[model samples]
Target: SQLSFINVQNRGNFRWPYDGLYQDEDGTLSGVVGGIVLSPDGLWSTSTTCTQTPNFLNAKTCPSSVGRWVRYAFNNANLAPNGEALFIYDTSNHYTIVLNLKKRLTHPDGYMMDLLTRQSYLFQFNGANSSVNLSYTGVVYDLVPGDYLIIRHNIDYIPDRVYTTSSSILAASSNTPLTAT
Candidate 1:
């Protein structure tokens, strides 16, 4: 079978597959913006919607005031030595995706042992600015051959207000391969 990489662009008010799956009740899926689906070959894709809930009535909806990030797994064997993932946010009208290496890092105290490495990328879909390209980069960690890569997108709302967002992990390479490993 051919490796299928699912790509979803400009997800706002429309209901589409994001970050793996979608839930109508939890308005916080995929970080309130754009999301991604992956292929077996380590290729990534994204999507957007224009749907908003009653809680977000006062706030903006998809393709309007939201963006997202996706998480995928990376295998050391499949990547070049010190490989990097190049991320580009398609800012065709007023939309853009920003890349943030580490916006926030914290621990709950005793429960935490090793520091968690967080790499985040943001997608800004701004229709008013008319900007074209927004891009960023992330370095591949020293992962084992059987480990997975987690990819996510960060989004900025237009009004710059804090709201609740949600997301989920659909499928990982650890469970199933797009093709036989």
Candidate 2:
């Protein structure tokens, strides 16, 4: 069986884990084109560069002015038998982010299943500094003899002032335990 996950969140004042800068078509030093940032301790950070091409079918183009794309990933380890992981961080300031999921399944008989799922999470960084840590749990299911699963991640970052609500999704295949680690 295959599995995937994606998380989109408003990341304010957070630096990219690496040093390279992202550029746009005009050659300007763009932030990020929607990619995942992993910390030294294996924690996930929401930092992405906006891109012109819509990677995910459900992703909508950000208005010309806000050229920010969502940042997240589909980790293969999350698909191992009884596999489990966490996705989270803190937004030191009040911000919002959108998380989406896309799954594809293929059967030996040429049958396929494609599905899209999404949720939003609002982070209010009440700390004195402009930093926050958000996290989530992930789990995968076992394959029934001939079954196959494919998981993808879709993320979108929206400015905090645009919306005031947030959402989240909790899914499980078998009875896998989800913890913050």
Top candidate when judged by lDDT against the true structure: 1
Q: What stretches of model 2 exceed 4 Å from their correct place?
A: 1-64, 78-80, 93-181
lDDT of 2: 0.25
Residues 2-111, candidate 1: write the lDDT tens digits. Answer: 22224533333322111122332333433433322211111121233433222221222333223232232222212223333323323232222322222112311101
The per-residue C-alpha lDDT of model 2 at residue 166 equals: 17
TM-score of each: 0.20, 0.17
What's the lDDT for all of these models? Answer: 0.26, 0.25
- Give, for candidate 1, the lowest lDDT window spanning 10 residues: 107-116
